[model samples]
Target: MSDQPRSYLVLASQRSGSTLLVESLRTTGQAGEPQEFFQYLPSTSLAPQPREWFAGVDDENILRLLAPWKPGTPSMETPQEWRARILDAGRTPNGVWGGKLMWNQTPLLTAWADGLAGRQADDPDAGDLKTAIEDVLGPDVLLVHVARKDTVAQAVSMWRAVQTQVWRGRADPEVDARAEYNADGIAHLHAILEDQERQWARWFGEAGVEPLEIDYHELASDTTGQVARVLVALGLDPELAPPPALQRQGNDRSNDWIERYRAERISV
Candidate 1:
């Protein structure tokens, strides 16, 4: 590895095929333990639960399909402590660190950064989303944006995963068997995801940061190649990037949902 920045973050929305890239990099044992570190909700101290994703819809049918909420224990760690833990957890033996962040989790990250500022004797220059990330990950971190062009398919995949609570691997047949497709739920996620992609674009424009862009179609089609690209961007040997280890989660049910959503959305 060259003396380039040893840390990187994957920026994406849910179901954007980011896991494929991060997990592929992780298998190489050179990359840091990349994870969705910012996805946990402050209230529950857990990754967004199935029902939490559908925040405002009053549709009982949608609610009933999702897994019931469990009140998770709130984290008691201070911002400094949380930062220390994350930094430590994400780092590799060679000091490279990797993590993933989503647009929706920006508020949580910023809030914790505020807490970090409060804990410091002198206030750190924590202001906006970009600054907050810099505060936590340092200024030299590489940003990679992974996005999916198919909003319907992405949202539909998310919709199914939300119901089954399985975001990885060949999903359990018993659990996924219970997951029902609802156009409204998928549409709700579709709007949120589309808006998130827009927000990422707007923020990138405003921040004047050109992140390494990874398209989902391309990433999914060439997982190892994409991982190699990221490794090269990080100034590491591209050969260290390993073969793809994850199985694609999309299936016939997901494709059907995507088509159904597109049809319904077009007619209405």
Candidate 2:
């Protein structure tokens, strides 16, 4: 095998079943850990709260809360260090690395990619986001664009996630919160999802990156087949036995929320 690492990215939007895809890839063991390495960007946008709320909290504490990975760990201080750490952590024993990035996180992704390529954060020569990513991760990096075909379902899922702030299940107990149906809120989320999809398309076109497009519905239906497809795309052995089933994350309230929104719209 070539000395260069085989890297790939799952390009997706919120509530697009990306977590499922990433977990499937990760379980393969041949595929590296694919996670939201740039999640800190979104955390940085957290709304300002009262000073008393964070009183006596150190910067490290704040970073630990905001960062996806354990903060204050070695090589976790600067963005560059974090990128290196993530890439190293994600690398498989076979030298394969995988990551998942959302379309809306362009700024953070660009900066991380630039750092990987040893360029200044705002380097103009870094080119577009795709180019920058390719520069660091290698030109042959596989791109998997996962999208949700059901816009209404995707929007409602995102809305509920935002409302409850419970994106995934953990060992810790979580307060189950049912999402209230708001036609206008769902509509706005739907529009944002549509716009982000368009942006991904435009970015792929401009960057001349031909991505393996996968749908959320199909992924949910036949996860094994979808994962095999991704493996094959990355020039890996598709004949290998599939990984164990991935545990479902989100609750099953999206469909009900969508129905309620439709009913409300019709009544309006």
Alpha carbon lDDT of each predicted model:
0.88, 0.70
For candidate 1, write residues 111-183 as lDDT tens digits.
Answer: 8887886634255554478888888998898999999998889999899889888889977899889999888
In candidate 1, residue 257 scores what lDDT? 78
Q: Give the TM-score of candidate 1.
A: 0.95
lDDT of 2 by residue, 1-268 (tens): 4533389888988889888888888888898877777655434433212221233544442323322422222223565666577779878998899998887667776766666667764667663686767655667788899999877788877766655556655222343343355566566667778888999999888877788999888888888888888888777877652653565554556677788877776345
The C-alpha TM-scores of every prediction are 0.95, 0.76
Cα error, candidate 1, residue 75 (Å): 0.7
Give the per-residue Cα lDDT of candidate 1 at 138.
Answer: 89
Determine the C-alpha RMSD for candidate 2 after optimal superposition of all C-alphas.
Answer: 7.0
Identify the leading candidate in terms of lDDT. 1
Off by over 4 Å in 2: 1-5, 42-76, 115-127, 169-174, 241-244, 247-252, 265-268
* Cand. 2 Cα-lDDT: 0.70
